[model samples]
Target chain A: MTNKHNPAALNTGRRPLRGAGINLFYLPAILILIVFTVWPLLSGIQLSFTNWDGYSPTKAFVGLSNYLTMFKDHNFGTVLVNTLIYGVGSTAIQQVIGLGLALLLNSRIKGRNIMRAIIYLPALVSAVIMGTMYYFVFQYQQGALNTLMVSLGLPRVVWFDKPAVSVAIIVIINSLQYVGTSMIIYLAGLQGMDHSVIEAADLDGAHGWKKFRNITLPLLMPAFSTSVVLNLIGGLKLFDVIQVLTGGGPGYSTNSVSTYIGLTYFSNQNAGYASAMGVVLFVIIAIATTLLNKGLDRLGWES
Target chain B: MTSAIRHAEAASRSTDTTGKGNGKGGRRIGHALAYLFLGAMIVAQLLPFWLALSAASKPSTDMSSTLVPRLHDIAWDNFTTAITQGGILTAVGNSVIVTVCSTVLVCICGAAAAYPLARRKTRGNKLVSAGIMSLMMVPPLSILVPLYTLMVNTGGVNTRWGIVLVTVAGNLPLAIFLYTAFIKAVPESIDEAGMIDGASRFMIFIRLILPLLKPVTATVVIMTSVGVWNEYALSNYLISDPGKQLIAPRVASFFAMQSSNLGVGAASALIAALPIVIVYLFLQRYFIAGIAAGAEK
Candidate 1:
């Protein structure tokens, strides 16, 4: 055991036993993850099947009744559709705005850094805070947008009082805050672009649209996928802004799956119901994102 | 090989043509238009926050008359009112403790576990890395239903520590992912060099690795801390006590309770956001880099 002078012994000294001993470094993390992450997740599945109201001592196994009840519940269709719209609509529109801005901002514009900072500044504040501020701006009569609209001799419309309008406002507000995320990713991607591809396209008489479609967009698949995935996921799990902005109100019309679960658990005290809904949402997100990734995989043809 | 050579020649020729052709008449106009577009976007981004700040300082009676702030309308009472009315100070304390403690735990554990994964290339290591990465993909709140129930059953509800545990768990995957990426960049020779001197693996990690990890550690710390500070969902659900809640939930309730009074709500929003805004303004460059690293991963 005392191979004190041999360098090669250092490698073998740690081969079988001591080498595996180093895995103890992983124990704290693995432990914390197991307790906090793994257990909760497994129990999440188990708890969903139990008729526990988050507090009631009497817990009984209920099988798939919670899922079946949710399937029959009238709000399920509304909430599920609302979630898909939020996730898809926001992700789709943000890509265009973010990519467009990133492209323009990537140019040698005056105060580009300042502009980039401004673009990204909204991302710094909590969505709660942003929603709070916009609550002022989107107020029915005295709000900033309505005031500006009236000044321009346009009709002053109610923004939050209506269900459809509220959903649209939520989408717009969220898209504005996160567009910079897509922008930053795209800007980074554009910055790291292999210029030879664009140059090669130029030599083939490929102009702006052609070169962008063929070369730039194809090369940006990584960043595009990153932006799309993050935004879609963020949209799906949205709770904070929906909480502050509309409170998923006007009769649950604006309720995302997350907000619905929060409401069911906290307000309604239907914990088992909430857990079941959570599982369903988890499965939905998994399936949706997997399909999305698969769809994007094909468009990433050059890769 | 021949086609690649031919393409390289064509690329150089096109680079000259594109460079010279694009530098002329069309560039100036496009630049001006782009500036105009960017200016409008900046205003859109800033207007609400600006109005909120302006409204915060204005007397409530005069808040709706104009969107601009006036010196005569400056109301120092709003800040005082915000503190007293909303339990703002208590919420801020809760946020600081929760954010700071969780970030520290996450950084330590994430950085620690990342080392062996980075150094030892094994099938198990790869599986762990993939597990951690996929964990990042799952909306952490997808598991919140169970997590919240577990906390409640364990007498963890309404506690700062409960929120902290949730925060650490949520932040770990990203922290580990980022740290492992950064730790991989550190030469394995450093560990080898330390090992030759009879330093235990743990000692090498402590004496050699931790210091080398300061930059990424800073990145992880700032990201996780800021995130935990803004976290509303966990704090909203897990911590039921009003006094123990973080500023995010408090700010939300403050504005909601005061929704009828835009002036006060604006003021409370500003007060809630002030600390984070100041921090962002200071460490903005690092913040950008940290977020970028976070995104690319």
Candidate 2:
């Protein structure tokens, strides 16, 4: 296949005269990206240095005050901690559960396809819808969960009273909803694995736990890496779930960076502070992603 | 001791003969365990949807009960009340108009924009691809202030077009990435064939390329539609007029109503989610595949 499609053969036959035509097709995408994406990002950096309330026509420069205020703000610190806990905690759970499900489904099992479809249903539902649905499930009174506990002679629990627990519930719900996506990716990776290695391990008296740990797990690192990065980025930017489930309440326990920025800008009318928070979030995400990419590259998993 | 020795000898014999019987037995157990675990997971995942559907069907008073509704009672009434009293119909209309217009425009623009990036080999292609990739990492909050300013300056505030454009801008990066990936799969031979036949680039795109993009286009359409329909932040900020809000914002407003009409609120939530859910159920396979594709490099 490589010999038949040699670049030299193509180049000898046809000089590249289609550059103008190609540029015509490419220009719009570049234009749109600059106008909408690149411009906003630069403006966000500029805004972070100003004292512009969202409604103000003219803005005064505040230098580094917004950044200093963010560091000093107690609520911002709490939200930062909350974001880390939610991101790491949810990513870990989803990775474990999703990989387990993928391995289970990859085996020769009846109804595997149907089970895959069923498990994936949640990913298709809107985050807002899921939040609304879970809200009723966790409500103090008239909630199905509380009713079930009472009927079973167990004490009723207030799911939202404790901020930490409510945030945990939000993380769990979001993680579960997205597990199917990572599971499928893992399944694809598992399917692409060479079976002869497992057979050889079996011949060497390795079975079950030994085979998985020594062979299968190491081979599935690419999928693991992909799932982790995707989940981490997603968890960092979570908004709709919190908005729907708890509305950043029982007093800001479940507020994430995304929601904090939203409220700061829209509700508090502090655009400059919000932009500072946004810039901070962007820098953190960029550093995290860069480290992850470098780590993956060192492991030679890019392919 | 004699019986144990006999059993050991029998196991050795079975192993020496390829262990087909043992393998079958072990596989059966594994299958059963897999099914059990998957069944439990599926049930847990579907519980919220079941609860939502049941609550939507029951009257507000009955919804608070522990028992599940045996049959849907307030179906038509809830829907009608949600539309009239809750003003969900207007929201739905706004959502549809915005979603449809934006989706069509994005499809056209995204495909056109992605074509060169997919086919051409140039130094700029790498930069373009990286730029699009990095765009995905930007949190919506990063641009909320500037985008809001842009909308206001352009007279887009409080208009359907404002929300629509925002949605388009937000979704375009991902759509272009997906389209480019799929477009690469279209054989260069087809393009050569079209060019040899003296077809103009425009004709080639419309006649040759567009038809071949059905699957990816379907994926993009369904994804963007669901996204636009369920969008809240942009609509919340941009559409302040009660008459101009979309489904999600309407649901929010219904929840915040001073009267506290839980029945109508629940009904509105149900209505907002039903279209996406039904579409999803029908296109589960494509939706799953599309998500997986989007996640892939």
Top candidate (lDDT):
1
What 10-residue stretch in candidate 1 chain B is worst by lDDT? B12-21
Task: Summarize candidate 2's per-residue lDDT along B1-297 as a digit string, tens digits.
Answer: 533433343334335434234476887897788678777898878777777666666665563642374383555566678788778878878888999998997788889877887888577786877788788788777787887888788898889777877787778888888889888899988876765555567777788888999888887887787678778766777787888988887777676571244455567777877787777778877877776666665
Writing each residue's lDDT as its tens digit, candidate 1 over A88-130 gives 8899988998998999888887788878887888887889998
Off by over 4 Å in 1: A16-18, A196-207, B1-33, B63-66
TM-score of chain A of each: 0.93, 0.91
Q: Once model 1 is optimally superposed onto the true structure by TM-score, how far is the C-alpha of residue A232 displaced, in angstroms?
A: 0.8
Q: Name the lDDT value of residue A169 in candidate 1.
A: 86
Fill in the DockQ of model 2.
0.30
